[model samples]
Target chain A: MGLKEFCFKKSLWVFHLSAGSCNNCDIEILDLLTPRYDIERFGMKLVGSIRHADVLLVTGIVTNKTKSRVLEIYSQASKPVLVIAIGACPCTGGIFTSSYNFAGPLDKVIPVDAYIPGCPPKPEAMLAGVVKLLKSKNRE
Target chain B: MGKKTIVPIGPYHPLLEEPEFFKLYCDGEKVVDMEWETGYNHRGIEKICESKTFEQVFYVVERICGICSTSHPFAYANAVESIPGVEIPVRAKLIRSIVGELERVHSHLLWVGLAGHFLGYNTVFMWAWKYREPILDMFEIITGNRNSYAMFTIGGVRRDISEENADKLLKVLMDAKKKISLLTGAVMDDPVIHARLKGVAVLTAKDIHDFGAIGPTARASGVDIDIRRDDPYAAYEMVDWKVITAKEGDIFAKAEVRLMEMFESISIIKQCLELLKKENKGDIKVKVKEIPPGIGIGRAEAPRGEVFHFVKSDGSNSPVRHKIRAPSYNCITTFRRSCIGGTISDAAIATAAVDPCYCCTERMTQVYDIKTGKKMMNAAELIKLSQKKTEEIRAKGDKND
Candidate 1:
C-alpha cells in the first residue's frame, strides 16, 4: 500500500458537508466522537477545513443553493481522498429526496466510496460503515 | 485598533453544521455589527408537508430536526387530533409526555456537552455525552429508534409504553439523573467556567421581548412564557412543575437554565411513569372516522422552545397548507440582540446561546482581523482559547494543592 493510502485509512480526517439535510446525520457524525461510540480510537477526526481532510463525510441531500459550494469544497480537499456519504439523506435523499429544492443524491455530483443507509443511522452502524469503506479500499 | 472588519461565517463553513451566513463587523477585539444570511438550510418542508397524507406528514415534520424530532410530531398530532374532534386516551397522553420529556433531557444534555466543548471543557463534553447515551437508549427502548422517532401519529402515538418496560425506563431515568447532577455540579462549581461564561454576551429582558425569543433563550432573560403552561398540551398541564428561568440573560444563564431543566425533565418523566401506572391507562390510540374542513393550530414546548404547527385542511386527506415553526425560528433571531458589542471570542458562544438547530450550531465561525486583513479566529480557535483559560486555571489549582 502507498504512504498516502495507509495514512488515509489509519487516521481519516473527515470534513463533513450537509447539502440540505435535517441535521440528524450531522449529529450522528458528531456522536461518533463521544465516549459512547468512540470513533477517535480509529483515528477519525472532524477537521475545520476541507484542506486538512483525508475523507469527506457528506450528509444531507444536495440542494440547489449548496450544489456548487459542495463541489468547490470537494475540490479543496487534497488527493487520495475518500468520500463516504453518511445517512439516507445524502445516499438516497431519504424522505426529502423528492422535494423540489433537492439536486439529487451526492453520488451524482461527487464520487462516493460508500453509502450508510438509515433515517439517521445508529452510531454503531455509522462506525461500521466507515470501517467497511476503509476495508474495501485496502486493495486500492 | 480602529479599522472595522467583517468576520463572514458561512453559507457553508466548518464552525456550523447548517448553511446560514453571518457578517460580523468588528473593531479589533470586539464585535460592533453583524448581519445574517439564511435560506441555506431551508428545504421547503412546509411545502412538502402539504402534499403528503395527514398520516405521512407526522413522519415529514419529525425529520424537520433530528435533535427536536418529537416536538414537531407532538404539535402536529395535537393539531390533527383537534381537527377530527377526537380525544386521545389518557395512557397516550402520559406516554407522549414521557417521550417528549425524554427528548428534552437528551437534547439539553447534548447542548451542555456542546457548550462545554465550545468553552474548552472536553472533560465536561465527554462526561455529559456519556450520560446522554442512556437517554438515547431509553428512546430506543420506547420509540424503537433514536433521532427521528416515528412514534406519533394523527389521533395519538403509534407505540405504547407497556407495563414491562416501565421499570426499565424508571431505572434509566434514575441513572441519568445521577449522572446529570455530577455533570451540572462540575460545570457550576468550576471557577474557570464562571470566568469564561459569566456576564458574557448578556441579552437583557428587553432584548428578549423585542426579538420575540422563546424557550431557554427567552427564559434566560426572565421572560416567563412557557407554552406548556400557557397553552398546555399533552400531559404538561397535569404534571406539577415550574418553568426554569434565569434573570442574568448571559451565556451562563442559558447553560444554567438548561442544566436545571435536565433534572426537571427527569422528575417530570418519573411523575409520568407513576401516573401511567396509577391513573392514565388503557388504549393508546383512537381511530378517527372522518376529517372536517377547518384550520387547527397546535403548539408544544420543544426542548428549544414552542413548536407551533398550523394545519389548514379543506376536507382532504392531505392538508392545503401545513405550516410548522421550529423554536429556532424565533430563537436564532436573538443573535442580533446578543452578539453585538461582545469580544470575537464570545461571538461563537453568544450566537450558539440559543442552541440553534442548524443541528451542529458551533461548528463554523470566522473572524477577520481588519488591520492584518487575515482571518483572526474560526470557531475551533475560539474553543482553544476557552480551553486554554481552563487549563491555566487547573494548573493554578494543582499548584495550590
Candidate 2:
C-alpha cells in the first residue's frame, strides 16, 4: 500500500454533518463513540472541523435549508474524503420524502462511498459499514 | 461599554448535535444579547404527518426527538384516542408509562453525559454513558430498538412486554438504581462541580412562568407543573411517585432535578410493572373502527419537558391538520432571560441546561443580516472557554486543600 493510503487507513478523522435529520441517526452515530462501541480503538475519531476530516459522515434527509451548507462543507474538506450516508433518510429519503423541505437521497447531492440504511442504523451496523468502506478503498 | 463582538455558533457546529444558529453578542467576556435562528433541521414533520394514516403517524412522530422518542408517540396516541374517546386497556396504559419512564432515564443520562463533555470533564461523560448502556439493552429486549422504540400506537402499544421481559427489566432497573445513586453522590459532593454549576445561570420562578417553561426547567424553579401529574395521562396517575423540584433554578438545580427524576422514573416503572402483572398479556390495544370529525389535544411529559400534540380529524383516514408543540419551544426562548448578563462561559451550559433538542425545536428558518459581519469565535472555542473556567475552578479547589 502507498504511504498516503496507509496513513488514511490507519487513522480516519470523521466529520459528522446533520442535513435535516430527526436526530435518531445522529444519536446512533454518537453512540459509536461511547465506551461500548468506542470507535477510537480503530483510530477513528470525530473531528470538529471539516478541513481535517477523511470521512464525511452525513446523517438526515438533506433538507433545502441545509443543502447548501452540506455542499459547502463537502467542498471544504481536503480531497479523497469518503462521504458516508448513515440512515434510511439520507439513503432513500425515508418517510419525510414527500415533505416540502426534502432535498435529498444524498447520493444525488454528493457522491456517497457507503450507505448504512436503518431508520436509525445500530452502532454495530455503523462500525461494520465504516470498516467495509475502508477495505474497499484499500483494494482500489 | 466594551466593544461588541458577534460569536456565531452554528447552522453546523460541533457543540450542537443538530443544526441551529445562535448569535451571541458579547461585550468583552459577558454576553449582552443573544439571537437564535432554527429551521436547519426542519423536515416539516407536521406536514408529513398529515399525509399518513392515523396508524402510520405514530412512527413519524416518534422520530421528532430521538432522545425523547416515546414522548411524541405517547402524546400523538393520546390525541388520536381522545378523538373517539377510546380508552386503552390497563395493560397498554402500564406499558406506555413504562416506555415513557424508560425514555426519561436514558434521555437524562444522555444530557448528563453531554453536560459533562461540554464542561471538559470527559470522565463524567464516559461514566454516565457507560451506565446508560444497560438501560438501552433493556429497551432493546422489550421494544426491539435502542433509540426509537416505536412502542406506542393509537389506542395502545404495538407490542406487549411479556412476563419474562418484565422480570429482566426489573433486574436491570434494580442494578441501575444503585449505579445512578453512586453517580448522583459523586456529582453532588464534587467541589469543582459545585463551583462550576451552582448559581451559574439562575432563573427565577417568575421567569419560568413568564416563559411558560415546563418539565424540569419549570420544576427546577419550583413552578410545580408536570403534564403527567397535572393532566395525569396513561398510568402516571395510577403509579406512586413524586415530582422532583428544586428552588435554585440554576444549572445545578436543573442537573439535580434531572438526576433525581431518573429515580422517580425507576419507581414509576416498577409500579407499572407490578400493575401489568394483573392484566392479561394479549390485552394490549383497543381496536377503533373509525374516527368521527373532531379535534383532540394530547400532552405528555417528556424528559426535557411537556410535549403537546393537537390532532384535527375530518372523519378521514389521515388527520386534516397535526400541530406539534415540543417543550423546547418554550424552554429555548428562556435563554434570553438566563443567558443575558452571564459570562460567555456560563452561557454554554445555560443554553444546554434546558437539554435543547433542535429537531424538536425547528419549525421555521429566517434569513437575518449580521451587522458586525465578523466571526470572532465558533462553538468549539466557546466550549473551550467553559472548560477553561472549570479547570480554573478545579485548580483553585486543589490549592485550597
For all the predictions, what are the DockQ values?
0.42, 0.66
Misplaced by over 4 Å in model 2 are B365-401
Model 2 clash pairs are none
- The whole-model C-alpha lDDT of candidate 1 against the native structure comes to 0.84
In the range B247-363, model 2's lDDT, one tens digit per residue, is 999999999999999999999999999999888555898889997899999999999898999999999999999999999999998999999999998888999999999899876
Q: After superposition, how far is residue B129 of candidate 2 from its true place, in Å?
A: 0.8
Over B1-401, each residue of candidate 1 has an lDDT whose tens digit, in order, gives 57899889887677787777889999988889898866656667877888888899988888888898999899998887787778888888888999999999999998998888888889888888888888888789888898888998766778988877889999988888888888888899999999989998888899888888899999999998888889988888788998999999988999999999988888899999989998645888888866789988899999999988899889989989887777887888778768888888888888777998863222122445658956667778878989999999999999999
Query: In model 1, which regions exceed 4 Å deviation?
Result: A7-9, B279-281, B359-401
Best by DockQ: 2
Q: A25-105, model 2: which lDDT tens digit per residue? A: 888888888899999988889999999889999999898878889999999999878899998989999888898889868
